[model samples]
Every structure is written in structure tokens, then in C-alpha cells.
Target chain A: MKELSVKELFEKKKKDFALSVITQPRTLNNTISEAQLNRPGMALAGYLDRFSYKRVQMLGETEISYLQTFSDDALYERLKEMFEYGIPCIFITKGLSVPHQMEYLANEMNIALISSRLTTEKLALNLSQYLRNYFAPKRSLHGTLVDVFGVGILITGSSGIGKSECALDLVERGHRLIADDLVKITLQNNTLMGTPARDAGWFMEIRGVGIVDIERMFGIQAVRLRKQIEVQVELMPWRDNMDYERIGLKNNWSSIHGVNIPVIYLPVSPGKNVSVIIEVISMNHILKTFGYDAAEAYTRRLKEEIKRQSRRNR
Target chain B: MQQKEITVTNKLGLHARPSALLVKTANNFRSELHIIMDDVEVNGKSIMGVMTLAAARGSRLVLQADGVDEDYLLEEIAKLFESNFSED
Candidate 1:
């Protein structure tokens, strides 16, 4: 339910999108709540039954051509009826010529009338991309995200559990680091996309080594700007009496902002080669995704062998 | 569930373009579809999975579908294979 004011959107993307405001509404504070951009095809035809007035209206060649077919009187009446809904703004795409009546009515209603040289499809694509990023639900997670064999794994644990050290090891093994300390996660279409926190510099803090710039330290291939997190790895300090799942029959999952991601609890102990274990974990995830569950297959084969042994005994 | 085995007849096999086409086709169906190559089976509707197959020419793969429209989904996937994914 976050609102992005139209004035701010224009200020940020005007030059890049070649947007020029023909007429500004009395109030420059009009805001867009949704990322969806409406073409207003149905509304232009005077059908308001299913109309969503909150969306930003776009007028393209098709809509302009339809308006041209109407007589002056009919056009005026139609435009009047449409503007009566108090829609936010109208963007004329493809540098289309806006009819005089359209501008007059937009100004009369104090609606923002804007024009862009980009084609309708291009404009729509750009606007949708920008708005999706702006309106996406985000969270700042205290973890590290890395890509191993194309699987994005987010490593989380209590402070000073060597999360960054493990990530650094993974980078040395050719895995790509996405975010180091604070991971910025955004849910896009049921997928969690993670990036480094924007405000925090792209640096990882090693207890003794201070902050290390992952990108500069390991070249471009060692870092990714963003990646879709597919799994979570929680590093727990080894305990003497804690029970851990030795058999992989039951896999754990963690839900982040309503999206369930596969999780693995890795117990960190001295001289355990945790980095190699994390690599295997990623490879195992890939195999499981391909429907090849190693543990299940082994269990099934073992049961079949036991059956055969009993038959031989008989 | 319905399934059919088809050979990759496209000259380039299931690379980026063909994988994209296959994924697009799979997405049109409401049924959940999977592509099995050898022992590895991946979601038919995912471009990444389809590309991961790296299936070459003459690579035989199985298309499996489960849901209300499994029959229709199999038919459509089979048609795409017969047409060599329109790559000719």
C-alpha cells in the first residue's frame, strides 16, 4: 500500500524516458498505488463497470485513432465522461498528436497530461519495470547470499558465526557473491530476489580483516548484482547433545514473506571444511530439483536388497 | 498424468531459443509439465530447467504432464516436437 508520487517518478525518469509534461495538474502530488498501467481502452468506450480509476491511464496510437473517429461534439462528451472519473494522468505514447479537446479537458480537470517519444510497448515495458521495482515488498535480512552452480543460497546465523568467512570461501571456489552482510530481499511474483543493501557499501566485514570489497577483491565474476534466492543455510555452532537429521528423508523449509524456501541447518565445527559442505549442499539442491533424491534412492535400493537377501535365505 | 517421449530434431537442439519456445509452450497449459532427460527431470514450464537439459540433436526426452489438462498439454508438446520447435 505504499504510494509513489507522480511528481517524484517524473523527476527521476523524465530525461531517461524522454517524458515532457504538457500540462501539470494544480497539485503535483498525484500518486500511483499500483504498478499496473491501464490503457483505458474500455474506459474510452464509456464502459466504467470494470474500470479501475486508480491506475495510470496511457493513450497510444490505437486510442488516439479511436478518438479521431468521433465527431467534435461526441469527442467532447466522451472525454468529459472519462475525465469525470478523476483518473491520475494520461501519457501519450509514440509522440502521438494529442487532440486539442483532450488537452483542454485534462487542464480543466486539473489532470497531468504528459507525452513521451517512446513507442507504447517500450514505454509500457519501461514503466512496468520501474514500478515493479519501486512497489515490490522488501526486507533487509542479516545474512549473506551467494550463487553456487546457479543456485542462490542465503546463509544466515547469529553474529560472528563466520557467515562472511564461509561466503568468502565460496567465492574462492568460483561461487558468486550477491550480498554480504545485510541482504536486501524483494518478493517478485512469488520469488525472493536478493541484493546488497543499497545504503551499505558493497563490503563484507571480516572480524580481523576489516571490510573487504567483494567485487574488487575477486573480479566481476565473483559478484552478482542480484539473484533469486532458492535456498537458506543456517549455520549453527556445534552442540554436544543436539539432534540433527542424519538421514535426508525429511527436508526443512523456511518461509520469507510468505515464500517457502528450502533450508539446511549446517553445524559449524573446527576443521570441518564447511565451505566444501556448502558446495555439496548446493549441488544436492540442484539434483533434488531435478527429481533425483539421492537419499531416497539409496533407501529404496537398500530395502530392495534386504528383500532379495531374505528370499535367498528361504 | 500423461507422458510422451520425443526426440530433439532441431538442428541446435534445446538451447536458448528452443528452450524459450518450449518453456513458453509449457506455460500456456494449466497442467504442471516436466521434461525428463536421462535420469534428470525438470519443470517443463521453467526456462532455466529447459535450458539446463543442454539436450542435443537426437536426444530423446520425455514430457510429462499432470493436472486437468494433461491430455491437451501432451498433445501440444508433442506437436511442438514434431515441428522441430519451429526451428526447421
Candidate 2:
């Protein structure tokens, strides 16, 4: 996620951000709003959504503003013509003055009136990059990731409860590690991806230990740069008083952002080998994806044996 | 027509560097090159197909070559993969 202000977004691009594209506030008679408004891009795209029009306006900000140079009446007529056909947002570079008339009206119409002190080239580069992001496909997720059985296992938990320590144990098991703690996951185009923080890959600072690197002693095979995260496992402190998913018939799931990943729940007990269970959970995920389900297979076999015994009795 | 099954002893399996090297060696053969990882089989030319298998270190992926120079192709492919995907 890149955070960019409207002015920062249109840094140097002039062709698209000129007055001709800006949907000027309709002020046939009087004054309007005070604060500046940043409008969504779709509003601008809607301005040119129709056909039978080809217009290109070059917004050169460094030039002495036309508003300052031309007569008030002449500028008014030019501004009116610019908006006559249908316009989007008007971007002014280097923080030029926006006559109170345009600003007030722009705010009312929900048109973005942006300005930046950046020179033309800088503004152009910035605008191009921002536009790229405007069209890039994306989805975000909430989970913690670690390498298990050569697969990235994203663990989801409610706030805090040893998800990091379990990942640390898995890292020590000679399985390469990916991300720990907060895992910033994203779907680029359609492929799922994840990356551990620069200083955070194998290091676990669990309240008492401060920092522990899963590499130095475990060697290079014990850590990885990035992995296609394919599984999600949730850890909960063991609750003997509560019920756990036993039959595996009701099937459970946990979604990270919009992308739904395979989920498995494991109750954490002091004596339980969580790392081993997590490993089997991942292998089970692989099996399920390849059209084999252990639970499903068991139920089918049980039904067939019941039929076989019934036939013998008949 | 000959088929050979060689285990991917390389640390990174068939990804990036190894895929590039395998593709280079496969391109040299007059026989069409194909790789089978478990039930999935794909052209040796496609790097994505080779990688999607997610065949980790020590996993075995079968290689098959079919042409008049099949024996030469098999031996060369074997020799190329025998060394871990390392330049040395």
C-alpha cells in the first residue's frame, strides 16, 4: 500500500490534469465551499465516459498562470469553455493560486483541485506512477506466515496467543521461514504472495527473549526470501471445556481480506507437539488440493463397508 | 524414445536458476523435453510449469526425451542436473 496525496499523485503530468479535464464548480452566480476536496478517480473517468469527443489540454504549471495574466472577464469565458464539454479534476503544479471562485465551486462539485510545488518533470513522473497504481489489481489479507513443509503457512489468531512462538519452533525444525508476527499479505494480479520484514524474518522477540534469529545457527536452508503462501492455520489455547472441530464434517474457513485460504484450527496444549500438527495440517492441505481428502475418504469407505455387511446379512 | 527419473537434489528444487539451466539444456536436444512431477507432466520449456510443481529440495521429477538422439539427450540432461544448480 502506497499512501499518496492528490497533489503528490499528479506531481508532473500535465496533459491529463489540465483545466480542460477539471470539472469546474458550477457558479453561474455565487460563492460555495471553503475546504479543499479530493474527489475519487471514477468521478473524473465519468466525465469522459461518453463518445464523440477528442480533446487534449496541456497543463504547464511553471508558466505564469492564465488567471493572473489574462483579464478577469476573458479568463472567466476561457474557464467556462474548458468546463462546457465535461471535465474532470484540474491539477495545478507548484502551488499556484486558485481564485476563490474556482476553489469554492470545485469543492461543491466534488472536483479535485490539487497543487504541488514540484517542477514539471517530477510532477509528470509522480502522476504516471500514481496512475499505474490506480489501475493495478489488488487484495489485502490479515494473517501471520511461516514456512512449513516447503509451503508458506499463514497463521491467523485473535490479537495475541503464541502464534509467533509456534512459527519460531517451525523455523527451528529445518523448514525455511517466511514471515512472522504481522504478515502483510497481498494478491498481485491473481497470484498470492508474502514477504518477511527486512529485520523480522527469523527474529522472534517474545517478551523475554528480546530477539532470536532462526538463521545464523540453523543455516541458510532454514530461511527463505519469499514464498507463495498457500495455507492458513489458526492456533487457540487448548479449551477442554469447549468443543473442537472433531468430525471434520462441518468444514471451517478463515478469510484474509478478500482471498479465502484453507484454514485449520489447532488447540495449543502444553504437552502437544504443535509443530508436528502444523506440519501434518500443511500436508493435508496439499492432499486436499490434489483431490484427496482423508476425512471424506474415511466416510466413503465406512458407508461402503456398512453396505457390504448389510448385503452379507441379507 | 527413453525416459529417465532423476531426483532434484538441488536445494531450491526446479526454480529460477535451475529452471533456467534445465531450459537451456532442454533446448539443446532435438528430442522434445518433458518433465513429470508426480501426476503432473509439462513441457520442459515452460519455467512456470516446472516451478508450479513446488518440488522442494530432494524431490524427484522425471525427465523424458524422444528423438533419434534420445540416449545423448538423456545423458546430457542427467549430467546437467547431477551437480546441484550451482555454477561451480
Candidate 3:
């Protein structure tokens, strides 16, 4: 149900895709409902069955060449046949000359006709990527995101549980901060990508320190535009009767937008070095990825030792 | 000082999670708590110490407490063992 207007797409990709409005309808209000683009070769060939009219039609070299085969009246008829449907817009790639009949139909039918200087394949790839991102599911998380040792760790906790302070400490230790206070998470292809909220500049609000611009203070190396959320670290105040994870044998996971992200429950108390632990966690995650599991290896060693000792006693 | 002999009834015994639960429960009271299993005795309020005992199922552990809340501490810890740490 997500829709994007042609004007917005043209305005956004005008420079990057080399897109130019060839023929603007009375209003550029036509909306693109489908993220996938379509090649109108089959429909232009007089076979409209299964034609996806709800997509942005692309007139590549082949489709344009096929249309060029017809005479003026025949080409007009062919273009009018496809334009009768509710096509959002049309893009002629490789900066192909927009056929006069096609432009006339586009303007008459209120479809935005655009031209891209890039090759057909390149334009399609870039445009599809943009459309996919535009339609991705998004949510905001109340926490800080930082890249510790190339691992994206989302530090979440209660409001005053030092999430920002820990992030600041990590930033001071040369790690990169992605976002603080509010992280905008987008789910794309089952992966959660974290970015700073649109209005949330590179500033963090520490409890006693007020707002500090991290970009200006720490330089460009200390901030990231976006990062894939690799792990989630939840910091909770240490409690007497609360059971914390003492061993890393069992992995904990938290689901965000149906994607399960590994979660670590870290207990915070007086004098506990959370930033150092998070750094270790990031390195440990890397180690695990490389097939070296310290806890599991130690447990296997302990089991073998226990067996050897029992055999000796017997 | 108060002491009681309790058996570890949980199927997984004193693993990481149960040890955490035992330590958390032991910390609730204002008492110096210790768990003695065979020749190894460990502080009941310390997760690492409690895990070191490695007390398996049906192992008899002696709970010793010394302080103002020793009796109440023993009672609460006994409840955790009776419930199998809420695990099957």
C-alpha cells in the first residue's frame, strides 16, 4: 500500500540517475504503487495480457526500436493502447529520443515521461534500489547505536541507565557512533539497518553534560551514516534477586520487525566498565563468527577432564 | 549461624542460570551465605562461586548462613530449590 509520487521520485533522483522530465503532464501527481519497474515491450507488441500497468514503464532500446518499426498511425495506436491503462510514469533510458506519439499520449493521459542518461540496466538497478528503500518498513528505537570494532551494537536501556554515557565512552575510545537518543531502523530483505533519525543530528545529550556535537568534537571518523544492527546490548541496573546470564552457552535473541537480533543482557552497577565489556562482546562476536567459541570449547574441555579424573579415581 | 542440608533437585543442576537464581536469592538477605557440596564450599551470594560447585541433580548441599536474616535467607533459598528453579 506504499505509494510514491512521480514528482518526488524525479526530484530525488534527478541528479544521481541523470533523470530529466521530458514531458510533464498537467500534474506530476501520478503515484508509483509498485516497487518493481516493467519493460513495456510485450504490451507495446499488442499483447496486453498480464501487463503490469501499475509500475513505472521503461522504454529501453529494444522496446523503443520495436515501436520504431511501426508507421506513424500504427505507432500512435500502439502507444495509445498502453497509455490507456493507469501507468504511473515512463522512463526512456540511455537518453533515447522520446517518440512524438508516446510524448503526446503521456501528456494526454497524464503520465509523467522522464529520460535518464544512464544505460537501461543501470537506471533500472538504481531506481529499483531507491524504490525498495522507499517502501521498506521502518521503526524508531529509543537507544544509541555505535559501531564497536566494526560491529553494530545497539545499546538499549531505561532512560537514565547510562546508554548515552556508555556510547560517549565508546566514542572516546575511538569507536564510531551511528545514532544517539533515537535510532531509525528500517527492515530491508530481513535485515535491520539503523540510521540516525532525520532531525537527530550528530549530537548526544548526556545527563549532566547537556548536548555535545559528536561530529565537531570527535571528527568525522567517530560517526557513521548507517550501519547494519549486528547485536543488541540491554543494560539494566543490577538487582539482588535478578538472575543475569552468567555463561554465554545459551544465546539470547530479540526480534525487531520479525528479524531476530542477538541480544546481550548486561548488568550495570557501580564501577562496572560497560564500554569495555561491549568492546569485548563485539570482538567475541567476531570470534564466534570465525568458528572460535571460547565458552563451548571450555565446556568440552571440562567434560573431558571430568571423564579422565573419574577414570583415574576408579 | 544457621545451617541446613538441601538437595539440588533441578534436572540441569547448578548450571549458569540456576546458579544465577541461587545467587540472586542468596543476596536478598543481610547474611553471609555459603553452599557446601562434598569437599567444595562456595559463597552462595556469588554467581561464579556458586557455579564452581557444579552440584548435579540429587547432590546434597549444606547451606550455612550467618547474620541477622540467616533463617529467612535459608527459607527463601529452600523455596528456590523446591521449585527446581522453575525448570522442568
Candidate 4:
């Protein structure tokens, strides 16, 4: 529910975007709820049916040239209707001259009008990417995230369940550690990226062994700033009563912020090398992405052999 | 369990593309697929594992498959090796 004001965005991105305000300075206080930008070509062309008021509108060459077709009176009326919709801000790209009527109406309506030297495409791409991170939904998870064979695996379990210990083992094996203890995850472009929480210490606490700084201990190659999480590995206490998946014939998934990620459960018991298991899981994820499914292959072969046996008997 | 010994005839042995193709073809069954070369045995369904075999041209590998379609899986793998992973 956080809001970004026109003034903040302009001030933050001015250096990179070279943006200059064209309307009254106070109009920069207007806020936009959406992270996405819109080029309201249709709205400027007298089509207000799909006008979005909560978007940061951009005027490119096409829109500017189209507005030139109208007489001063017609332009004034059209722009008036458009600004009355309460658009958060307008950006004229490619250093285009803001039409006199447009600038006059922007000031009259108190809507912040801005100009940038970049083309519409470059500005839109940059602004959207920047805004996406600011507006993305995020959550902090109690887990360890590691990059195994280029796959991001989030290890989650109860406290003192050896999450950090397993991560250490993987790190020793050359996999990169992203975040230990507290993983801050965010959904970016449908991919879940995880980072270390600002408050959490860079070191991980191991019972009886104490804290270990992964970067200091393993050098720069063993730590990562952030990673796109591809799988979730949950460590559960082993129980004789529970039936764990032995064949991995069916896939399991966990959802965070509506993004579904593959999940695997590894039962923790004495002498079980959970770190190696996690590494295999990461490798398996890569294989699956390349259209290889060992479990499905087994089932398919089973069905084929069964059919062949029945045919031979007949 | 089904097992077969096949020599890698491809000009490039098992490089990235061939290893990927072999892994893809190996995963289409319900079985534990393994590629054995000398002292090492790696999961056939894993590209990294398969690459670890480092099977060069003319290197013989033991293709071991355990599950229902073990025979079909081995046969398909054999066909791929025979075709040199389709890289003439």
C-alpha cells in the first residue's frame, strides 16, 4: 500500500533519466499507485474509454505528432478532458517540446508534467524496471538460500534443524551461499529472488560450533548477493509413521506471493547427508528444466512393459 | 535392472549439447539411470552428473537403468550413442 510521489521518482531517477519538471514544482507531490507506466496514445487521440488515471503517462513522438493535428481550441479541450482524469504525471520523451496548451492545462490542473532526453522506449523500460523493485511484494522467511549448480534452493525447517549446517556443507562443496537464517524474498517478473535480511548478521549460528561468516571463511566465490530461487527443500524430522516419497513420481510445489516453486522434503536422521541430497536435488532441477524427468520416465517404462507382457500372453 | 556397454562414437564425445540430449532422453522413463565410466558412476538424468563422466570419443560406458522401462531406456540411450548424439 506504499505510495510513490512524482517528486520522489523525479528526484531519485533524475540523474539516470535526465528528467526536468515542466509544470508547477508543487505538482510533483501527486502520487501514483501502479508501478507500470503507460503511453496514453489513445487518450491523447480523443479516446478516453481506456484511460488509466493511476499510471505514470508518457508522451512519445507518435503521441506528440498526433496532438499537433488538433487546433489550439481542440487541443485545449482534449487535454483538459485528459488531465481531469487525475493522471499522476506526464513525461514528454525525446526532449519533445511540451505543447503550450498541454503545459498550460498541466499547470492549471496541478498535474506534474516532466521532460526527459531519452526516447520513450528507453525511458519506459528503465522506469518500469526501477519501479517494479520498489513496488514488488516481499516477505522474510526463516530459511537458508543457496545457489547449487546454478540453481537457487531455499532450505526451510524449524530452528536448530541444521539448516545452516547443511548450507555450510554445500558451501564447502563449492556452491554459493545467498542468505542464512533470514531470507528476504521478492517476486520480480514472476521469478522469486532472495536476499539476506538487513538486520540479520552475515554470520550463521551453529550450536556448539558458534557463528561462521561464510564470505570471510570461504572467500568471495562462496557467497552471493542475491539469487532467483528455483526450488524449496524442506528438512523434516524423520518419523517411522510417515510415508516419504521414495520414487519422486509426483511433483510437489510451494507458493509464495502466488508464485509456485517446486518443493522437496528430506527427512533428517542421523548419518543422512542432507547436503549431498540437496545438491542432487539442485542438479535434478536443472535436468527437469531440460525436459528430463526420471520419475516420469520410470512410470512410462512401467506402462510400456506391462502392455508388452499382456500382448505376448494374448 | 537393465545394463548395456556402449562406446561413445560421437566426434566430440559427451559435450554440453550431447550430454543435455542424452540426459533428456534418459529421463523419459521410470528408472534410476546411471552412466558408469571406470571408477565413477553418475546419474544419467543429470546433465552435470553426465558431464562428469567426461566420456571422450571411443570411451566405453556402462549404461545401468533400474525401473520398469529399464530396457527401453537403455535401448534409447544405445541408439543415441550409436547415432553419436546426432552430431556427425
Candidate 5:
């Protein structure tokens, strides 16, 4: 199971959320196994049934005000009961002061008590967004991801098959390079988002030229941070007898992280401008998205012409 | 087809230079070669594909070759890995 320690969350979002450690700092190592945060209103009110102890608990203004009405001894008893469930940690939103009794029991129980200055709604919204992304499924692929006219094309092929060379050519023609060599893909909300490997930066390795920095050579406009992988273009060595895709009547799809992306196999050979072909593919893809398929339209016209010829013969 | 499981013993693993050497050796034969690591298989004759494996020291890889010269292809690839791609 993927778990994030409370220390990691605090360290990562300390500046963004205006967070601070309230209780014993030693308890910050508590692991948060769930991405959801819970408001322990019912538990604080002495109802423990169906309590989501696995999630990080949040105490907003409502819960804190409720505890404010109770005596210190009564508040300690109430908090002690809730902490017995082994909850991950608690966040006090709105920069609220941590009650003496609550902090005492939290330290006694070794559960982290954190405070954030953001409003309750804003804190919950931002924290949930971060948590969801932290738990997303990720994979790395050996290919070049580029943004071609707003369409993300992942260029993949064997080693020395000119994938990088083709991507560089596309960059020269005004397309943006997202990643080269290793593309880090994350599945977020059913979309396969492609980004560069953490260490790859904006570099491309050409067979003869070694390594070249794309951003430095082509400027900032020639590269992007991440893009949605809408299509895949696989370059293969051209063979004499290979029957390639002559008509685009059928689409080939590749599934990654349960998302299906359209794939195009293009054969590479001497003197073929693969980059230009990729641009055309991107434009055709955009046209298809707008309900215009050139191959299907051409086939329809051919069928009509054949019908006309048959009628004249009859 | 010929297959062999080899371990990457090179100190730096299969970085750019080692991957290049491995691909160069694999291309000497006419057989189709594939290197499988952790269920992800890639073309062995492609430098980028081999580098993508990122097989560090002590990583295990399965090398498979198919064609009339499959035996020779596997032998050559196995020798490269066994020698740590000629890196100390």
C-alpha cells in the first residue's frame, strides 16, 4: 500500500498551506495510508461507529468551538476516546489555537497535531488535490513525447531508429518537446499524462551528436513540462514486402494504465521526412476529432462512383 | 530461438556508454534480439531501448534471440554482459 508519512506532508506543504507542528514533533512519522481527510465531528461528539481512523483527521472551526464549551478534564476524556482509534494525524484549520487538553492528550497518545492558517474549505481542497496526485499510478516509457499543434504525440521505436532525431526535427518546425529518452507517465482521472523523467530535463540524445539541450538551443517555446498523450507514433525500419497501413479505415489503439490511446505505425527509410509525416498525422487527428475522416470520406465517394457506373451499364 | 539470463555486473550498470556497446554487439548478428527486464521487453539492437531498462548492478535480464543465427547472437550478448560491457 502507498503511504505518506505525516512528516513528508508537513515538509512538502509547510510553505504552501502555512502549516506548523502543534503537538509532539516526534509523532510526525505517522503514516497516512488514505488520500481522504476526515472531520472527526461525530467522534469528538462521542460517536465512534464507522470512524475512518485510517485517514488524516481534520478539526475545523466547528469542532474546535464545540470542544471550547467543555471543561479541560471533559475535553481530555473526549479526545482520549477518539485517539484510541489510532488515527493518522489531525489538522486544525483557520489558524485556530490548539486547546491545552487536546494537545496534552495528542502528545500522550503520540498522534501528530498540526495547524494550518488556511481556511477550512481551502485547506481541504488543496490537501485533497495533493493527496490524489501523490497516489496516482505512474510508469516510465522509453520514447519521446511532444506537443504537435496541441496534439501530444509519443514517438517510440527501437534504438537508433531515429526517434530523437525525428523529435528534434519536429521541435525545429515549432512543436514542443515534453520529454525525450524516458517519458514519465501518470494516470490521472483516466487520462495518461506524459512528463519528462525527473532527471532528464530538456535534453535529447542524437546518435552522432551525443547530447544536446533542447531548451537552451531552441529557447523556452520549444519545450513543455507535461502533456496529455493523445497519440503514439511508432517508427519502424521499412521493409520491401511489409504491408503497411495504406488506408486509415481502422484505428490502432494502445492501452496504458487502462486508458486507450490511438497509435500510428510509420515505417522509416532513407530520404523519408518522418517529421513532416508526423505533422500531417497530427493535423489529420485534429480533423478527425472534429468529425472529418479523410479515408472514410474517400471510400464513401469511391463506393458512390461504383454504384453510378453499375447503373449506367444496366 | 536462444535465450539466456544474465546479470549486469558493471559498476555503473547499463548507462549510455555501456548500452551503446551492448547494442553495437547485438547488431553484429542478423537475428532479432530482445532484452526483457521486469516484464518490459525492448529491442536489444536499439541503444535507447537497452538504456531504458536502466538495469543497475546486480539486475537480472533475459536476453532472447530468434533467427538462423540465434545461437551466435545470444552467445555474443551473454559475453558482453558477463564482461560487464568491458567496464571495470
Candidate 6:
């Protein structure tokens, strides 16, 4: 199917992204998706970041009566100033009757006015969750994240594949360990991010070693609270039949949730340098993301030399 | 306009990841895609609907996509299932 324009995509998903509240308006234009969801309890304020454009401006309607004491025209002018700043939609609480003019303006602007009868605190929790999924980034890699050699490497493989051991080694070497085993990964915006358990910190449970706490042994500086999982090091069993990439040519992207994070297959061998290989892989991924392809560069250089040799022979 | 039945051979079954992939692929076409499992017809584009069926590995599913691109869409899905569902 053809790709939809940003406006079209927004149109389909905007309604679901909202909390059911009544519409209020300032102008009769009925032209904009900007809205002012007013709630004196200030519940939806938490979700204001992603739905930042969907202006659910929290205000009590009684406050409007206070402004009305000044003059009808003055009250309208004041509300207009608040709206020009920006709003996708607005929900007002207390179920106060909206000004007839504001209602007409909300309908004209398409600023979706929602009046939730719930208390501000209750609506905040509900609306925050309602809007969270839309703002939350999908696609997260499950692995122990470590920043080895200044590279964010997420080590993944079958359970009991020495993933914890490799991370512990990296930590001992003065590298930072983000999470050891059962990393909590989440996406905010488009980036694949990572974090260790708040309670456990970077402690890892190796079958033989028991729960060896890395932060205590390696110091706080040796651990990072969170890191972006830039590179994936997938540990696979050493199988003769399984085809491992001898040459790093085409890249691999492991789909998490919906986002595909770059993945690398690091076959677990008896004495392979897992940490070192993973570090190099991360650096290589960073380089590639910045436009340097190591394999392609090598191929190009080799081709140049071959061409030079042919010219000399001629 | 076309309909065919095939077995889901993926080891993980039609869980979150597979269901999402199927839905995303189906959404890319104009055909109205539906997956029938255990005599239950479910919309392929609805992630929650397709997931509710819980069709695991070796589970037979009837697929039907009715639209202008029905034939082409079904062909791609049939090939995708045949190539990637079973042991490679």
C-alpha cells in the first residue's frame, strides 16, 4: 500500500490517543486539532509530553466565571491567548457548562473537547495510561547491556550461554555494566533503551557463582543505570551445520516488539573472546551507522590495488 | 476472493511477534485479510483479535483475503508461511 502522509496517519490514530472528555472551544473556526482539555485536578498533566500537542489544558470552569466578571469580551480574549500557544485537544473537569461561544469554537477548530466527570486525580491516572502506549517506543532487546570500550553492546543468547560471565568480565575491566541478565528494555521515541532492575541493580546470578553483585564489587562508576542498546550480540551454540558469517557483509536486525535492533551472531565457543568480539561489533555498528562499512571499505581498497597492478603490467 | 488453508509451523506459535508481523504485512495490502483457526474467523489486521485464537505450531489456519489484490496478497502470505513457518 502507498505510504500515508503524516496528516493522514495522525487523523486515523488521534481519536484513540484521547481520553473521553467533552469538547470546548474559543473560536467558531472549527479548523484545528488543537484543544484545551481542562481539568482542575491536573491528572492528564503527566501525559502532556507525547500528547503535548493534544492540549488538554487543565483549568476549572469556575475560573472562567471569575474571568467573566471582568467582561464577556475580556474573558474571550484571555482564553484566546491561552490557546494560541498550542493544544491538540482539551478536557475540562467538574462537568461545568462550557461557554456557548467556546463550544462553537471547539467544534470549528476540531480541538476535541472532553469533559470527564471523574476527579482530577482519577482522570490523570486513566488518561496517562490511555496516552502512554501511543507515546511508548516499541522494540526492545532482552539481554545484559554493557558499555564495553565506550560501545553499548546488548549480549543475548540462549539461557546459560555465559552472557552474565561476559558482562562481569567487562565490568572488571573498568567498562560499565548497564544490566546483567533480565534487562528491562523500553523504547521512548524511536531509540531502543535499556535499564537494570531498580531493586537488583546490576547484580547477576550465575549458576556456579551465585548472585554476585557487580556494583558492589566494581564500584558505582563501573555501572551505568541505563544505556541505549546500540548493538546486539546473539550467542549461538557451536554447531557445525549452522552457517556463521565468516565475513561481516550484510547486517542482521532482530525485531523487538516492532522496532528492529541491529543483531550480531557471536557463536559461543570453548575459548572465544566474547567480550572483545562484542566490543568490536558495537564499534563496527556505530561506524556503520555513521556511514563507514569496514567490509565494503576493505573490498574497495583491494579492488583499487588489483586495478593498479593491471595498469603496471600493461 | 481467494481462500486457502495452511498450518502454522513456526516454533514460537502465533504469539505477539508473529501476530504483529502478520498484521503489519496484511495491512500493507488492500485485501481484506482474515485468518480462520478452529472454525473461528478473525480479522488478520486486528492484533488482539488474531492473538485471541492462539494458533500455535502445526495449527491449521484458513486464510482469505477478498479485494482487488486478494490473489496477489494470498500468494505472498502463502509463500511466506511455506518458506519461514517450517524448519529451514
Full-model lDDT for every candidate: 0.84, 0.60, 0.87, 0.86, 0.87, 0.65
Q: What is the lDDT of candidate 1?
A: 0.84
Model 5, stretches more than 4 Å misplaced?
A: A69-74, A240-243, B1-88
Q: Look at candidate 1 and give me any clashing residue pairs.
A: none
TM-scores vs. true structure, each candidate? 0.72, 0.46, 0.85, 0.70, 0.74, 0.49
- Tens digit of lDDT per residue, candidate 2, span B1-88? 6899987665445544566567666666678878897788988766556545555555677888888787888888788778776643
Candidate 2, DockQ to 2 decimals? Answer: 0.01
Q: Which scores greater on lDDT, model 1 or model 4?
A: 4
* Regions of model 1 farther than 4 Å from truth: A15-18, A24-29, B1-88
Looking at candidate 4, what TM-score does chain B attain? 0.97
Per-model tally of clashing residue pairs: 0, 10, 0, 7, 1, 34
Tens-place lDDT digits, model 3, residues A202-293: 99898876988999999999999999998999999987656566668889999999999899999999899999999999999999999999
lDDT of 4: 0.86
- What's the TM-score of chain A alone for every prediction? 0.90, 0.56, 0.94, 0.86, 0.92, 0.60
Using DockQ as the yardstick, the better of models 2 and 4 is: 4
- All candidates in order of TM-score, best leading: 3, 5, 1, 4, 6, 2
lDDT of 5 by residue, A78-125 (tens): 888889999889999988997888888889888999999999999999
Better of 2 and 6 by lDDT: 6
Model 5 / residue B85 / CA error / Å = 54
lDDT of 2 at B78: 88
CA error at residue B31 for candidate 2, angstroms: 70
List candidate 4 segments past 4 Å from native: A199-201, A209-211, A296-314, B1-88
Candidate 2 residue A226 C-alpha distance from true site, Å: 3.4
Worst 10 residues of 4 chain B by lDDT: B8-17
**Regarding lDDT, does 1 or 5 come out ahead?**
5
Q: Give the per-residue Cα lDDT of candidate 3 at B80.
A: 93
- Give a tens-digit lDDT track for model 4, residues A1-314: 97898899999999899889988899998997899899898887788988887899999999999989999999999999988999999998998997899988888899998999999999999999988898999999999999999999999999988999999999999999899989999999899999998755468888898877878889999988999999999999987545456557567899998999989888999899999999889888898999998867754554454345334434
